[model samples]
Structures are given as C-alpha cells and as structure tokens.
Target: MRIIIAGAGDVGFHLAKLLAYEAHDINIIDMDDDRLQYISNHLDVHTTKGNSTSYRVLEEAQISKADLLIAVTESETTNISTSIIGKHLGAKKTIARVSNTEYIQRKDILDLKDIGIDEVISPESLAAKEIKRLLKESALTDTFDFEKGVLSLVGISIDEESELKDKTLVETAYLNPEYSFITVAILRGEETIIPHGDNKFMLNDHAYFICQPNGVERVLDLAGKQRESIKNLMILGGSKIGIQAARQLSKKYNIKLIEQDRDKCFELADTLPNTMIINGDGRDVELLKEEGIDDMDAFIAVTGNSETNMISSLVAKNHNVPKTISLVENMDYIHLSQNIGVDTMINKKLIAASFIFRYIRKGQVLNLTTIHGVDAEIVEFEVKEGSKILDAELRNLDFPQSALIGGVIRGGKGITARGNFMFEPKDRVVVLSKPECIRKVESYFK
Candidate 1:
C-alpha cells in the first residue's frame, strides 16, 4: 500500500512504524527535519521536509497516487485542511486528527465525510475512553470488549500469588477446562512473547487473554484477581483528557477533580455540576490527603507532565488505592508501568494511531486494537467465502504460529475456539498477531 502521513509527531511516528512492519511504501511529511531524520534512520520510510498544508509538498509526496493520507499534525486546522486537500488531490481516503469533540459529536450534521475527510479522531476522547475501560475492574491492567460483548481481551500482571505463576500453559490448561479462554501474548520486560504450550508464566509477566463474554471471570481467576466494583473516583489534571474523563465517568461514579489552575477549576465546576472541582496542586501529597485520597476507590493522574502523572499514581498506590491509572506520553515509559507499580499507563497517540491503522487496514477486518505497551494487535476478521482459513482444521491450516485465534462469533453467538475447530463462511474470528507476521495472518482470511 502507498501511504502518506502528514506529521512527525508521536501519532504519526507510531503509525509509520506500524506500517513499516507490513512493508508498505510509506511517505512522511513534516517541517521538523530532526524528527524526520530520526524516523528515517530507525524506520524504513521516506521523509520529506515541508508543510503538509502546502499543495506543493502534497504533490511532491505523490498524494495523487496514495492509497491513504493521514493528517495528524499538532494543529487541528492543518489536519483538516490537509485531509481535505489530499483527498481532492486524489488520495483514496483521508483521516484528520482533531482535538475538538464537537467535530466528532456533530460530524453527522457537519458531513465531514462529504467534505473529503473520511474520518476524524480525537486523542483526548480516545484517552478518556481508555481510562474508563481501565476502571472496569480494579485488577485488570487492560481490558476491551469486542463486538459489543461477544468477546473480550483482558491483560493482567502475574505476581507471586498467581496460581499459574512459574507454570507453563500445558500445566494451567486445567484452569480453563471449559475451553473458554486462551492466552494470546506475554509482555515480559521489554520483550513480547507469543506464548505456546511450553511457555511458562513467569513472575511479573503481563499476560493477555481473549475469551467469550461469559469467560471473563474465569480469566480473572486464572490471573489470581477477583472482580471489584469502583464507586468513587479522583481525577488529577485539568487537561482535555481529564475534563472529558470526568464528564464520561461522572455518570457512573462519584468524582472529585483537582486542577492547579483556579480558573480552570471554576470552569470545570460550571461544566461538571455533579463533580466536585478543587483548585489545588495534585502533586502535593498533603493536598491529596486533605482531599480524602485515602477514601478514594480509584485514582487517575492524567497531567500533561508524564513524570508528574507517574509520581501521583505512585503516591495513590502508597495510599492503598485499589486502582491507579496514569497517563504517560513518553513511549519509552510504557513498558515500565507494571514494573513501577502503576496499574495502567496510557499513551493517547498510540491509541489513536492504532485506531487509525485499523481504519486504513485492508480486507475483511471488522475491528483492530492494540494493548498498551504490548507489541501485538487483537484483530476481528470476517471469514470471506472460499478463504484459506475455512479449508481445514485450525491445527493443520499452517496458521502463523505467532498468531492465535481466540474466539469466533458464529450464528449470533460467541464460542471459544480450539485446534479441532473448523471455520465457516461469515464467521467473525478474533486473532492476536505480532507485528512480524501481521500481514501473513491477514493473507489467510483474504
């Protein structure tokens, strides 16, 4: 595929890196020569130094023959303009990264698609949704429901108390006697492992699973965690993510929002009537304690500063908060979340990049999502007629060993799939594939 990404920022860089794994012809445009140079040196992508909004730069990047154009610059105006102009210049599809929720909320009335932008993504909104998902269960490091509830992908950190700790998948197979769940990948330190029967569940390993909706409790049990309800919540930072998260989560939980800016706190009070807005420095341990931090069920730190967010979350952990979620913008710090005791460290750029990547993906892909800090993607694919996947039993299909089929939604019901299972046309299959073999796995469904 020929693709053009109009930014060298976090989202653009991550998207380009992901596309490089598929061996796509990628062209990146940005004015920052240093960022472009960094990406060019590490990734197999072409870089051009210029303004994405400039028609000359778009033409120079061969936008007319591009299969996809993604505008993700820091400026929302630039992103919208570039997407529209690129689409007019003959790019097959265009996506614009936006910061305003109104653009997405009112897209139906605005008809952005008719104006050439095929899709609009909001990092703040995406990050807010991620925070809400993480709060579903205090113990889960990460969780996402697929197809509205047919299947779920859950991640947990293995500790000394975990029954499966130090045991191989073969030994733990009895825990899932109903054949309802499967381990997809393990994130150990900086390495990502697509586990097999012999792969042992080591201490501190971040294990990921895919199971039917009915199997979530069992998956949690296997990870040595019990389900817990979250009733009280605290949000630090008055950034867009914090505000949006407060708005979304306030409907379900009692919320206390803290912002250092007095003016922002007043604005939040007016905007979120049900939420208690306090004007104070969230980083001040005394201030947090004064606000009843010890009584809170969950603590979320989403300040603009990654270091501050991590520190606040750690402080909350020290206070015995059951769930602590911190937002870390630095991609390098993602792997250190569990090791440092933060339940989940989120990167909005990565979440947006993954969503956009799914949008531009080829074939019968129904949905595609990536776990925070994990080097694999969980994709839902439709089995097309006459596809190679339906020709034989799963064990004999020679499916990429790095990819695992977790579950299948067939005949309006979801089932945990096994090696003896045979696929049928129109079945929606969920799979976890590492970057190295993503394209190879997609080929089987084509």
Candidate 2:
C-alpha cells in the first residue's frame, strides 16, 4: 500500500514506523528538516520537506497515486485542509487528526465525509475513553473487551501473594477447572514471552490472560487483587484529556481538577460544573496535600510535560492512592510505569495508531489493540470456511512461535483456547502476535 503522511510529529512518525514494518510504501511530508532527517535516518520511508497543504508539494509527493493520506499536523486546520486537498488530488482514503471533540460528536451533522475526509480521529477523546475503561476495572493494568464483552483480555501484575506467582502454567490448571481462561503472554522486564505450559510466573511479571466475561473475578483472584469501586479521583492538568475525562467520569466519581493557568481553570470550572476546578500548579506537593490527595481513590496525571505527569503520578503513589494513571506521550517511557510504581500509563499517539492499523489490516479483523509497553498485538479474527485453522486442534497446528491463539468466541459465548480446542468456521478467534509474526498470523483469516 502507498501511504502519504502529512506531518513528521510524534503521531505521524509513529504511524510511519508501524506501516514501514508492514513493508508499505510510505512517504512523509513536513516543513521541519530535522524531523524529516530523523525519519530518513531511522526508518525506510521517503521524506519530503515542504508545506503539506501545498498543491505543488502534494503533487511532488505523488499524492495522486497514493492509496491513503493521513494528516496529523499539530494544527487542526492544517490536518483538515491537507486531508480534503489530498482526497481531491486522488487519494483513495484520507484521515485527519483533530483535537476538537465537536468534530467527532457532530460529524454527521457537519457532513465531513461528504467533503472527502474518510475519517477523523481525536487522540484526546480516545485517551479519555481509555481512562474511563481502566477506571471501571481498577485491578487490571489494561483491559480490552471483544464482541460486546463476550471475551476479554486483561493485563495484571503478579504479586507475592498471588496464587499463581510461583506456579508454572501447567500447575495453574487447578485454579480454573472449567478452562475459562488462558495465560497468553508474559512481559518480563523488556522481553515479551509467548508462554507455554512450563513457563513459571515471577513476582512483578505482567501477565496477560484471555478469558470469558464471567471469569474476570477468577483472574483477579489469582493475581492477588480484589475489585474495588473508585469513588474519588484527582486529575492533574486541565488539558483536553483532563477535561474530557472529567466530563465522562464526573457523574460516577467525585472529581477534583487542578490546573496552573487561572484562565484555563476558570474555563474548566465553567465547562465542568460537577467537577471541582482549582487554579494551582499540579506539581505543588503542598497544594496536593491541601486538596486531600491521600483521600483520592485514583490519581490521573495528564499534564503537557511528560516528566510532570510521571512525577505527579509517583507522588500520588507515595500518598497511597489505590490507582495512579499517567499520560506519557513518549512511547519509550511506557515501560517505566510498571518498573516504577505507577499503575498504568497511556500514550494517545499509540492508541490512535493502533486504531488506524486495524482499519488498514485486511481480512476479518474485528478488533485490534496494542499492549502498552509490550511488543505485541491482540487481534480478533473471524474464521473463514476451509481455512487452514479449521483443519486441526490449536496445539497440533504449526503456528508461528511469535504468536499464540488466546481465546475464541462462538455462539455468543467465549472459551479459552486449549490444546484440544478445534477451530470451527465463523468462530471469532483472538490471537496475540509479536510484530514479526503479524503477516503469518493474518494468513489464516484470508
């Protein structure tokens, strides 16, 4: 596929990196020579230095022959204009990254698709929805539901007291006699392991399990955690993510939002009537103390500065907050969340990239989610008639070492994929695969 990306910023660069791995023909455009140079040096992509909205620049980049054009510049107007112009220039599909929630909320009323924009993505809104999901399942570091909660993939850190902490995968069968779940992947330090029966769980190892909706409590029990209801939340930063989270969660939880700018605080106060908005620096330890940080059940740091978010989340952890979620823009810093003390870390760019990738992938990929700080993806695929996967049991199949079948949803019910499990046509199979094995895994669905 030929893809032209406007902007060499974080979102654009990350998207280019992902597409490059798939061996797609990628062309990146930006005014900054340094960013373009960085992409040229680090990735196998064509870089053009110019204003992306310029017709001459689009023509120079050969946009007329492009299969897709993605506009993710910092400015919303630039993104919209670039997508509209690129679509008119013969691009088959166009996506624009936007910051305003109104664009997404009123997309039908505005008739944006009529003007040639195929899709519009808001990273802030995506991150806010992710925060809300995490809050609902506070015990798990990450949670993704498939087929309207028929199946779920959850990530949890093992503690010393966990039943499966020191036990091998085979030994844990007694914990789930009904075979309601399976341990699909393990993240130990920087390495990702597709586990087998003999693999032993170590303390602090982040384990991912695929299970049915009713099996969530069992998974939490084995992971040494109890489900707790969150009542109070303290959010740092009155940015787009913070404001959106406040708007989404204020009705269910008591929220106190802190912002450094007085004008922004006033704006938040006016917009979020149910939230308590304070005009103060989030990094002020004294101010946090006065705001009763210790009483907050959850602390979310989403400031513009990555370091500020990390530090504030750590401070909340120090104050014994049950959950601490930090918004780290840098993908490299995601690993620090688990290594340090933060409960969860979110990167909006990565979230948006994963969403777009699912849209691009061929076959019956119903959903796809990238694990935070891990080099793998959870893809839900629909089994087709006469596919190789339907020939034999999962353990007998010559599946790639970099991938494993996590679970299957059939007849409106979810079941953990076991050695004896046989694939049937029309079954929704969820597979967790490392980057190198994505193509190989996708072949079965074709």
Candidate 3:
C-alpha cells in the first residue's frame, strides 16, 4: 500500500514504523527538518520536509497516488486541511487527527467524512476511553474489546499468590476443565511467549488471554483477582487526558477531579457537570485524603509530570484504593507500570498508532492487537482455499516457532486447536507472534 503520513511526531513516526515493517510504500511530510531527517534515518520511507497542507508539498510527496493519507500534524486545523486536500488530490482514504473533543463527540453534527476525511481520531479522547475501561474493569491491567465486546482480550498480571503461577499451560487448562478462554500471550520480563502446552506461567508475569463475555471473571479468578465494581474514582490533574476521562466516566462513576490551576478547575467544572472539580495541587497527599481518596474505588493520575503521576498513584494504592491507573507518555515506563504496582499505564500516541494500524490491515486481517510492552501481536486471519495453510493439518505444517495458533473461530464458536487440528477453508485462525515474524505468518494465509 502507498501511504502518505503528514506528521513526524511520535504518533506519525510510530505509524510509519509499523507500516514500513509490512513493506508498504510510505511517504512522510513534516515542517521540522530535524524530525524529517530523524525519520528518514530511522525508517525505510521517503521524507518530504514542508507544510503538508500546501499543494506543492503534497505534490512533492506524490499524494495523488497514495492509497491512504493520514494527517496527524500537531495542529488540528492543519490535519483537517491536509486530509481534505489529500482526498481531493486523489488519496483513496483519508484520516485526520483533531484536538477538539467536540468534533469527535458530536460527529453527527460536523460529519468529517462528508468533507473527505474517512476517519477522525483524537489521541486524548482515545486515551481517556482506555483509562475509563481500565477503571471500570479494575481487574485486568489492559483490555481490548473485539466485535463490540462479544470477544475480549484481557491482560492480567499474575501475583505471587495467584493459583496458576508456576503451572504449565496444559495443567492450568486441565484444572479449570471448562476451557472457557484461550491463553494467547504471556509477558515475562521483556519476552512475550505464545504459550505451548509446556509453557509455565511464573509469578509477576503479565498474561493476556482471549475469551467470551462470561470468561473474563473466570480468567481473573485464576489470577487471584475478584471483580470489584467501581463506584467512586478520584482523578488527579486537569490535563486534556485527565479532563476527557473525568468527563466521560463521571456519568457512570462518582468522580472528583483536582487541578492546580484555578482557571483550569473552573473550566473543568463548567465542562463536567457530574464531576466535582477542586483547585488544588494533586501532589499533596493530605489533599487526596481530604478528597476521600481512601474511600475511592479507583484512582487515576494523568498529570503532566511522570514522577508526580507515579507517586500520586502509589499514594492512592497505599491508601487502599482497589485500582490505580496512571498515564505514562514515555515508552520506557510501560514495562515498569505493571511491575511497580500501578494497575495500568496508558500512552495516547501508542493507542492511536494501534487503532490506525488495525484500520490499514482491515481487509486481510480479521483483527489485530499489540500488547503494551510485549514485542508481539495477536492477529486473526481468515483462511482461504487458495491459501497455503489449507493444504494440510497443523501437524504437517512447518509453522514458525515465534508464532502460535492461539485458537480458531469457526461457525461462531471458539476452539483451542492442537497440531492435529486441520485447517479447513474459511476458518478464522488467531495467531500470536512477535512483530518480526508477522510477514512469515501472513504469507501462509495470503
């Protein structure tokens, strides 16, 4: 696919990296010469340093031949203008990143799609939704809903007291007996294991599994966690992400939001009717206690400073809050988020990148998700009669060791298959593999 990206920031760079791995013809446009040079040096993509909204720059990037154009520049106006021009200039599909939450929430009013933008994504809003989901569930470290929550992939961190710790995959399944969910990926340190029968889960490892609606609780139970309904949530910071999450979750959960700036607090109060906005420093532990942090079911920290967020989240945990979620913009902090006792750490840039990547792979991929901090992807592929995978049973195939067939979705049912399970035509096979092996695995299905 020939794709043109109009941004050289974190989200754009990440998207380029992901698409370049799939051997897509990519062209990136940005005004920053340093950023353009950085992207050019790092990625195997053509770079044009200029304003993407300008016709001459778009022409230089050859936007007319682009299969997809993603406008994710820092400015919302620039993104919208770039997408609109790119679509008019002949890009097949166009996506824009808008900063205003109103445009995304009131999509029926603005109708960006009518103006040539196929999709609009707000990283702040996307990250907010993720935080809301994490707080509501309060059991799993991460959750990805597929097919409108019919099928969910959840990640749970196994504690020292977990019942399934030190047990092999086959043994755990045998003990459970019902076989409700499929264990897809295990994150141990820096390694992600697509579990085999012999694969044993260790303490402090974060494991992800795919299951139906009723299986989420069962999976949590296996990891020694019980579902706790979140009633009250205390949020620190009045940043965009903080305000967005509080506004969305306030309708369902009792919310108390704190901001150091008096003006931002007033703005939040006006924006969020159901939420209580306080003008105070969120780093003050005394203020948190006074605001009833101890009685809160969940505490979310999304302040500008990472250290402040981490420390406040720790304080909330120390105050006996059942769940704590913090936002970490730094990619390096993702691994430590789970290990250091914070329930979940979210990055808006990464979430936006994942969402866009899934859209780009829509036709060939039934579904695709990347686990945070895990160097692997869980991709679902539909088997065709002409595909190499349909030639024989799984036992006869020389499948890559890095990839594992997690399950097969056939006839509206999920089945965990062994090496002897035959791959019939139209079977939707779910595979878990490192990013490096995705090409090898996709070739079999293609």
Candidate 4:
C-alpha cells in the first residue's frame, strides 16, 4: 500500500517502521530535517522534509495517490489540519492523532470524521485504559478480551507453585482431558516462543494462553495465581493520562492522585472532584507511605519521566502494593519491567501505532491490540464471503503454526471453535499471532 505518514515523532516513526518491515511503500514527512534524515537512513522509507500542512508538501509526497495518510505530529492542530487536507487531497483514508479528550468523548457534537478525518486516535487515553484493565485483573500481566467478555488472551508469569511449572506441554495436555484452554506463547529470558508439545514451562517464565470467558479463574488455578480485587488506587502523575485514568476508574475504586507541580495538583483538584489530589514528588517513598501506599490495592506511576515512573512503581511494589503499573515512554524498558516485578508497563506510542497499523491492513479486521512488552498481536477479523478462511475447518486450513484462532463471535454469541468447526460469513474471529505471522494470517481473511 502507498502510505504517507506526517510527523517523524515516536508514533509516526514506529508506524513507519512496522509498515516498512511489511514491504509497504511508506513516505514520512516532518519539519525536522534531522529526524527525517535519521528515519530515511535507518528505515526503508521515503522521507520528505517540509511542513506536512502545506499543499505543496502533500503533493510532493504523492498524497493524491496514497492509500493511507496518518497525521501524528505532537501538535493536535497540525494533525487535525493535515488529516482534513490529506483526505481532500485524495488519500483513501486519513487518521489524526489527537490529545483532546473532548474530541473522542464528544464525537457526536464535533465529528472529526465528518470533516474528512476517518479516525482520531488518543495515545494517552489508550494507555490509561490499559492501566485500568491491568488493575482490574491484577494477577495477570496482560489480558485481552474478544467479543466483549466471551474469550480472552491472558498472560501470566509462571510462579514456583504453578502445577504446570516444570511440565512439558505434552504432559499437561494428557493431564487435563478437558482442554479448557490453549497455551499460545511463552516468554523466557529474552526470547518469545510459540510453544509446541515438547516445550517445558519454567518458573518465572511469562506464559500467554487463549481461553473462553470464566476460564480466567481456571487458568489462574492451574497457574497457581491467586486473584486480587483492586479497591484503592494511587496515581502518581497528574498529566492528561493520570487525570483521565482517575476519572474513568475513580467511580469504582478509591483514587488518590499525586502531582509534583503545585499548579498541576490544583488543576486536577478542580477538574476531578472525586479524586484526592496532593502535591508531592512521586519518587519520595516517605510521601507515598504517608498517603497510605501500603494499604492501597494498586499503584500506577505515569509521570513524564520513564525512569521516575519505573523507580516509583518498583518502590510501590516493594511497599507491598498488590498491583503496580508504570507508563514507560521508551519501549525498550517494557520487557525489563515485567522481569523486575511491575505488573504492566504501557507505551502509548505503540498503542497508537498498532491502532493505525490495523487500519492499513486489508480484510475485515474489527480490532487489533498489542500486548505490553510482548511481540505478539491480538487481531479480530470478520469472516466474509469469498474469503479463504471459510473453505475448510480451522485445523485443516493452512494456518500459520505460530498463530491460533482464539475465539469467534457469531450472532452476538462467543464460540471456542474446535477442529471440526467451520466458519460462516460475518463471524468475528480473533487470532493471536507473533509480529512475523501477521501478514500471513491476514491473507487468510483476504
């Protein structure tokens, strides 16, 4: 596909990298000549150094023939203007990255899509929602639900007490005749393995499994993980993400927000009436303790500084907080965070990039999400007539060995498919696959 991405920031750059690896015709535009040069030198993409808002720059990037135009500059105004202008310039689809929470919540009042923007993505809000999900399921490192709550792809660190620990996949398969769930992937020290029969699960290894709804308790039971309910949450940042998270989850859980800046603390106090806003450094352990950190059910650190966020989250975990989540800007720290004990480390840029990547891919992909620190994706695609997926039963199809069909939604009901089950048109199927197998898996739905 011919794609033009405006802004060489983290989101745009990451999107370009993902698409370029798939052999797409990618063109990146940015005002910073240095960033454009950096991307051009490292990635196999055409870089255009100029203002993306200019008609001349869009024309120069061949936007008229572009299949997708993505505006992800830091400035919301620039992204909005670029998407609107790019759509008018003949881009097949346009997406704009926005920071304004209002644009997303009040979409009916001010429809950005009506003005030519096909989609509006909010990274901060996405990160916040991820943190909320992590808190709700504190035992699991990651959880992705498909077809509402019918099926889920859940990740858990293998504890020493787990029954499956030190057991090979073949042994476990015989031990449980019910076959309640499917073991999809395993993350060892630094490598992610698409497990087979001979693979033995080790202690401290991160394991991802696909199971039907209400299988969470069973999965946790087999993994020897005790479920914990989140009651009290302490938010360490008063940024947009912090405030938005507090706003969304405060209704169900007791929320306490701490901001280092006095002005930001007051702003949060005025904006969020239910949350308790305090002026204190998140790095200060004494301050956290004074605010009943030990008594809290969950602690979330989402400050701008990645290092501070990581350290503060570690401190909260050390303080015996049941769950700890950190917002890390640098995607590199995500893997390490899991090993060190943080429940989940979220990256907004990656979330937005994956959101846009799903749009560029052909087929009836209803939704797509990447697990934190994991190199795999949870893709939801609809079965349509003339699609190759409907020709035979799932097990008989030439499906990628590294990927598995997790669940299917038919007529608003969720079904865990067996080998003999055949897909019907309009059935929503969820597949879990590694990054390398995404294209191959997408081809089935095409």
lDDT for residue 12 in candidate 3, whole number 0-100: 97
Tens-place lDDT per residue, model 2, 1-446, is 99999999888888887788788999999999999999999999999989999999999999999999999899999999999999999999999999988989986689688998998999999999989988977788888899888889998988887898889998998999888888889988888999988999998888999988768889998887888889999999999999999999999999999999998888888999999999898899999999999999999999998889999999998998888899998767878777786788999988887777777874447878888878898988899998889878888888998899989999998988878889888899999998767878988777
Highest lDDT scorer: 1
Displacement of residue 445 (Cα, Å) in model 2 is 1.9
Over 4 Å off, model 3: 107-109, 146-151, 167-176, 197-200, 212-218
Candidate 2 vs candidate 4, lDDT winner = 2
Model 3 scores worst on lDDT over the 10 consecutive residues at 144-153
Q: Write the per-residue lDDT of candidate 3 for residues 274-388, one digit (tens) a residue.
A: 9999889888989988899989999999998877888888899899898888888877777777677777777888889888989888887989987777778889899987999
Model 4 lDDT tens row, 187-206: 88668787778999998888
The segments of candidate 4 whose C-alpha lies over 4 angstroms from its true place after superposition are 21-23, 32-34, 41-43, 106-109, 113-116, 361-363, 384-396, 408-427
Global lDDT of each candidate = 0.90, 0.89, 0.85, 0.86
Backbone N/Cα/C clashes per model: 0, 0, 0, 0
- Candidate 3 structure, TM-score to reference: 0.90
Regions of model 1 farther than 4 Å from truth: none
**What ranking emerges by lDDT with the best candidate at the front?**
1, 2, 4, 3
Q: Which residue pairs does candidate 1 place in steric collision?
A: none
RMSD of each: 1.9, 1.9, 2.6, 2.7
